[model samples]
Each structure stands twice: as C-alpha cells, then as structure tokens.
Target chain A: MTKNLSNVNQIIAKYQGDQSALIQMLLEIQRENRWLPKPVLARLSQKLGIPISQIYHIATFYKAFSLIPQGRHTVSVCLGTACHVRGAPRLLDRVTDTLKLNPGETSVDYKFTLKTVNCLGCCALGPVMVVDGEYYGKPSAKEIEKVIANCD
Target chain B: MKKLQKVTLTINDREVTAKEGMTILEAARDAGIYIPTLCYHEKLAPYGACRICTVELSRNGRSRLVTSCVYTVENGLIVKTESPKVIKVRKLLLELMLASSPAKAIQDLARQYGIEKRRFEADKTNCILCGLCVRYCSEIKQANAIGFVGRGTERRVVFHPEIASTVCASCRECFSLCPTGKLPSETDGVCFDDLTLDDFLKTQQSPA
Candidate 1:
C-alpha cells in the first residue's frame, strides 16, 4: 500500500500541487494505476485540500476516468453513424461472444475490457474494433479470436 | 461605501423599483408578486437547476423564457411571471419532475398548477436532482461530504464515505435543506462500495 502511495506522491509533485490541475492529476493517476483507488483519491484530497466528494464528482463525470479496475487490454468497438449502418452491431456481437463480456464490462480474468464508443473518428474505417491501440476494420470472428489469444 | 443603485421594471404590468443586480424573482417578491420556485434558496447561489421559476421576459417586442433566479434585472425589461407561455413551460417541467419523484413538495406544486397526471413513463429514481443538498453541503457547510456522481440519467447524489464518515454524523445540515427528504431516509450511500449512511453513524457512535 505504501509503495503504491509513493507513486501517487510523485504524480502530485509533478503538478507542483496546483489545485486547478486536479483533473489532469487524476488522469495521470488513472493511467498509471489502471483505476483511481479510494485510498489514492483520499490522499489526493488531503494533499490538494480539495474534498474527496469533489474528486469523486470529477472521477464519475468524465467517461475517461474509471473508479474500478480496468483490464490489461481495452477492446473498443466503434458504433458511430457510419459504422452503425455498416455492420458495427454484428462486429460487437462477435467481440462479445469471444470475450464473454458485455459492453462497459471487464472480463473476469481481467484480460480485456469491452466497451462501445460513439466514434473513433475514422469513418473510412467503419465497423472498427480497437484492441490495445491496434485497429481492425470489419475483422472476422477468427481474427478477433487470434487477437484475444495474442494478448497475454 | 458605494450606494446601492436602483432600476425600475414592469412585472405583471405593475411598475416596480428594485436594487441594481437583484434578480427578477427578488424584485417581484419585494413587490408582493408570487412566482413559484422549488430550487431557489436565499442562502445558496442561484443554480437554476429547477426551471419552475421560469418567467417570460419581453424586451423591444422580443419575448423568451428565462429562469428568474439566475437572470439579473435590467431597465425596460417587461417580466411576466404568470403568462400563458410561462405557465405552459412550468407545467411541463412539473410533469417531468412528477414522473421521477413522489415527494410531497413536487406533488403539492403539481396540485397547485392543476397537474393531475404525469404523461411520461415513470422512471422513478425518487430523486428530482434539484442539487439543493449537494450545493448546500458544499457552499453553506463547507463540508463537501455529499456530492453528485455520474452524468445525465446515471447521475445521482452520493456521500463520500471517507469524508462523510468523519464529518456527516454530527453535521447532516443538508438533511433539512433536501426537498424530497430522501437524504436522511435513504440509508444507502448510492455508490462507493456498500458503505451506507447508517454505517457512518455507527462509526461516529463507536469512537475510533
């Protein structure tokens, strides 16, 4: 617990303990820790003099922050307007069947987190599924299986 | 000391003088005019979360609805607190709130406006989300123990267990400020594991 807390102290020090950079500090913490643990948030609230309630408010407000632990690999299926018309739903089904996890849920083994995004800003790559920063446009079920198997 | 500036404006065709920077609601109330409101508290800042205090403001023949709590008074601004346009908006807002909450305060206002039935499908979370309790806890008490979490339809009040467990048992000042009266009764702390308000109270009573 103390080992994890020293990293939190480093992140806070990087910001020079500025109160206005609360959101930025939290995002960095989330990136390193995979989630904002309650103890980390409480420590931030104490050091910054901002209340824990306020920190929790910011944590839950943005879609980027995660209060709970996320998986090692993030699998996001684009459900954008272009993708919707071009078999995004079918693509999502294949991913879910392989992962056995619904959208916004992490796998029981913590291997992958499956979530749907409105857009990945690549309309040309309609029905795109991004797994661990690698994008596949309209990938087959076998390809998805290979992708999941590749991730340790 | 700077002198308080005054401005004159028409409310329901009655010419009234009000202090400069005072809201239209405050001016109307000073003139003994009635404007219904659910989320306006004198102590708290003007949130304008509940649009029940919406009034029609007409200037130079251009009319639009504005929440009286947040809108500051201006010269030559014709304010209508009970116009047909204002009534229609307030009624719809009341209907939306009525569908979500069965609180006595909302029901009483609906009755006053003759809102007999809610047209929308009931998705009652029993929280109108007027944000009174959250704002009061942050602003008045300076103890940001309770606050809102999530966004849009998922948004609801939550009492932070770490802070609330220490500060809330004795200082539940936001309890009386809640219009729904659900804060005290709803023992569930809404989020942050299974920690409830009762648990907080228990922690306080047991002494360390």
Candidate 2:
C-alpha cells in the first residue's frame, strides 16, 4: 500500500542509476513491503530501464525472492542431512497438518508461510525451524502446535 | 590496483573502517571486534547460512538485524555486535542449529555456551553443523551434487530425482567437505560412472 513511489524512487536515485543494484534494491524494497507486486517490478523496470523479463528472471533465480504473497510469519524448516535422518519428514507432516498447508504455501488466514531450506548451518540443532527469523530447535509435532499457538 | 572505496562504520560502539563492499564481519575484525561466526572463512564469500553472526545495525535512524557476513558496510552506520538481545537471539539460533546437527564439534561449542543438553527434542539426523558439503556442492563445486528436497519438516538434501552419476561426479568433493562422516565413499563402481536413483538409495543402505 506504499503507493507513494517516493521511497522506491529515492532508493533508485541513491544507487546512482546503476542497474546492477537492481537485485539489492529489490530485496530492500521487498523487505519493507513483505511481497513484491507486479506493479512494483514494472516500476523498477521502468526506472532501471531493464526488461521486465530479465527482472523476473533474476527474481525467480534467487530462492530468497518470492513472487507470491507471504504471510506475516515466515516458517523455514531446515532439511539438511542431520535434520533429515532425525525424522524431519514427520515434523514437516505435523507442520502441514497444523497449518493445513504444504510447504511453499501460506496459511488460510495469511498468518504463516511455510518453507523448507536445505541447511541453516546450525546442524547442532537437528530439525530446526526459523519462525520470522527467530530460530526454534528440536521441535516435535506436538511442540510445533504449542509454538504455533504461542505465535497466535 | 584500483583502491577500493573505504567506509567507516561503528560496530558494538567501536568505530571501524573497511573497504566498500566488505562484509560487516570483515569490518568488525579490522576494528578488532570479535564476532563469533561459522560457515564463514576469509577465503570465501559470505554464505549467510549460519545465523551465528547476526548483528543489529542502525543506519540513518532505522535499525535492523542482519548477518554480518553478508551485510556490507555503509557510511555513518551504527552497529551493535554484542548486547543482551543479540546474545539471546544468538543463543537460540545456535541451539536450533545444534538440534539438527549432532556432530561432536557442534556439541563442543554448545558446551562452551553452557548448554549441556539441547532444550528441544533431539532431531537425531546425520547432518553435521558444518556447511562445507552444501557450500562446496552448490557454490564452489557447481555440481548441485545434492540439494534440499521437500518442504517444512520434510526438507532434506538429496540427489535430484532419478539420481544419476551424470548429475554427480562422485568425486568425493562433498565427502571431503562434509564436517560429519555422513557422506559414504563412492568406491563401489556404482557411483563411479553413473548411478540411478534406486542405485544411489541402495548404495546408501550398503556402503562401499
């Protein structure tokens, strides 16, 4: 809803018309807005003079970027080797059941977005999850229910 | 050589200057401030996989938490590397990382932090906390030798569907880089040339 292109324009200006900063600038904008809309990408394309296809390509290339809407809370489950052997699949099942949505999907109320990551580099805590960038380790299906309840 | 632009930033109340495009970790180290980090080596680009180097930065009246390894230095930036909030967050992040990785090194670090047993249930997975396997396979190796499959709790790193040696070199690069000994040897001739998904899974069950 930040329709006033002032901030976005300001960001563009700060980069000194460098199109290379496109991805970085987009990341900053998305961080503030939560999700990138088509209009914003088009605006970026117009300002940077880059093709919308190229912009979309770069956006899709990075796992961090998302074209669809994301929830207020982002839940990232680590699916590294350690977590996998430790029954991470079961944990994921629990999360899906509780949230009533699979990975890469958002909850019905738009409160949570569930994602699975390869590794968070915190293998010490197998079966790890990051809720809104806050790490939660060694969670059980039952424990996940409590965690989700606490989030509410 | 063209001199890189240098920028001054404050980290944990200490003023430090570093070359433009340098990560917050490099800047903090140049300023003699120690910020614990894993999965970050001076020889490599910042991967931002490990959440241990999370720091709070304030620039132009706006503050945010970011991984110092991936965050670049900006002029007139204010950073807090160590504080109660940061410590708490770091502790939790480390704890979470530990739960997934049951490597001895990870456990040793946990002990240093006074965490004897994990607060959360043990994941009992074979993924060691070290990110070498993932990093080498994805970034340096460019083989995508393995990748995370599934989502949410079911997420895991595995050879692509119909795992074939054509997709993987079986060069043992991942095995060497793995901090844990989870990667099995490829001496079995099956992975030497090309392997099918069934062959790979069967290999995992029976080692070379």
Candidate 3:
C-alpha cells in the first residue's frame, strides 16, 4: 500500500497534480504501464478529488484509454476511403495473420495490439499500417512479417 | 416578497413566455409546441441521451442545435422546435432508436414522424443506453446496481458485476420505464446475476 502511494505521488508531482491534467496523467500512466490498473485509477481519483465513477466514465469515453492489459506495440491499420481503395483490408489481414490477432484485439503473447483506424490523415500514404510511431505505407506480406519479427 | 421570475422567448416564430429556470421542453410543451423526446421523464432529472428533442436555437444569429430537455429558457432565445435542421437531427436520432429497439414504443414514436423504415442497419442490442433504468435505480430505488460500462461501440447498460444481485431483487421501477426491458421476472435479478463476460460476448456477436 505504501509503495503504491509513493508511486502515485511521484506521478502526481510530475504534473504538479493539476486537476485539468487528469487525462494527460492517465495517458502517461497508460504508456508506462500498458494499461490503467484499477488501484492506480483509485489513487488518482482520491488525489484529484474526482469521483471514481466519473473517472471511469472519462476513461471509457475516450478511445485512447484502456483499463485492461494492453500489448507492447500498438499496431493500427487504416481502413479509410483512400486506404480501402488501395487494398488496406487485405493488408490488415496479412498483418493480423502475421501477428495472430484480429481487429480490436491484442496478441496472446502481448507483443502487438491489432486495431483498425478510420483514417490517419495521410491519404498519400494509402494502405498505411502504423506500428506505434512507425508508419509503413503499402506494406506487403513480407514487410509485415519482418515487422512482426522485429516486434519486442 | 419572493416572486417567481418570468422569461419570454420566441419558439417556432410564436412569442412564448415561461418562468425562469424552466427547460425549453417544458416551455415549449406549455406553449403547445410539439417536440419529440425519448430519454426524458417528468419525475426524473433531464437526460439528453436520445437526442430526439433537439431544437434549433438562433440566439444573435448563431444557430445551433440543442437538446430541449436540458437547455434552459432565457429571454430572447429564438427557438425553432421543428426547423429543417432540427427535423434532420431528430430523424437521425429516431433512426438510431429504431436500430436499438423496435418495440412498440419506438415504433409508435417513429410512425408519428412518418418514419417506416430505418436507413441504417438495426444494431438490435435492444437496449438504447437511455439511462432511464439506471436513473430510476439510483434516484427512486437508491440502488446503484446498474450503470454504463465500457466505451464507444463496446458500451452498454449493465448490472455492476458484483452488486446487481442483492440490491436489485425488489426494485422494478426501472423495468417499467425501460423501452426494451425484459428481465427481472418474479425470480428477480436471477437473470442479471449470471451476467458473465461470455454473455457480453454473445451480445457483441449479435449483428450491430
């Protein structure tokens, strides 16, 4: 319990515990821990004077937050108009086959999370597969497999 | 002497007056203006979930659609309960309601607006997330056993996994208010108590 308190306090101090910074604090915690633990969220609610239900509402309202465990790599395939016309669905299938995950699901090994995004605003890079910060444009099966092997 | 404050506004090009702190819906109803709504109840607090009571407000020429159930009255607020834009928003919302539940209540409401078919595929989850049941449980019964869980397309009204059993046995106020409720028979909470992740998956597997 003391360890949890100190960990939460360290995070709270990093942003000076601003009320408006709750979302950002949750995001940073998600990045570090790969998910928002219930205990961590409770600590945040207590420290921020926010109701746990409200915090849960906010966390669930946004697509960015995840309460359950997440994989190390966030892999997203664009299925927007441009990507669709350029064969984004097939590319998504190939990536999913390589990682053994379906859309809106993470791999059992916790290495990669496979998801489908509407658009990434980079239509020029049609058929885009974003593995975290790295964007792969028009990637073929061989390229996706290589990317999968490279994933930690 | 404490006197009630009064406010006047123009709704649908007709001058209407109402007391201050009254919602636009109440004022419009008093003025005999017909505004469609689904998630509103007189006994409970205003819930803008259904978005069917949206109206166009043109205050100072900045027109925007606002839900009448929650938007309060202010003097000089130009309200259009059946403006073209307002109708369009209501039509979209009704189609969504149709998608959620095709019960007689939903169908009867849609038929009033000449809506016979749904433009989009019916999700068929049957529960529209109106929060009527949740609100009734909390406010009237003081039982917080049910609430909104998850997010986005994965969102749904659900009994809290741990608390739905003991507290919800005798409470059926929400059931009466639910547009598509079919649970809580004489056994009471027997169905909701067995809600597992598998049940959630089964609902998700249904064509949405």
Using DockQ as the measure, the top candidate is 1
Q: Could you tally the backbone clashes for each prediction?
A: 0, 18, 0
Better of 2 and 3 by TM-score: 3
DockQ of each: 0.44, 0.03, 0.20
Tens-digit lDDT string for candidate 1 (A30-105): 8787778878988998999998778887887887777778898999899989999999999998998999888878
TM-scores, all candidates, are 0.91, 0.48, 0.74
RMSD, every candidate, angstroms: 5.4, 16.2, 4.6
Which stretches of model 2 miss by more than 4 angstroms? A1-152, B1-3, B41-45, B59-63, B128-131, B160-170, B184-208
lDDT of 3 by residue, A25-104 (tens): 88887777777777888789788876554566677666677766779999989999999999997898798788877776
lDDT of 3 at B107: 81
Which ten residues in a row are the worst by lDDT in model 1 chain B?
B199-208
What does the lDDT read for residue B142 in candidate 1? 87
Instruction: For model 2, state the Cα shift of residue A126 in Å.
Output: 37
lDDT of 1 by residue, B4-69 (tens): 889999999999999999999999999999999888899999899989999999987899999999
Model 2 chain B: lowest-lDDT 10 consecutive positions: B199-208
CAPRI-style grade of the A/B interface in model 1: acceptable
Taken over the whole model, the C-alpha lDDT of each candidate is 0.83, 0.68, 0.77
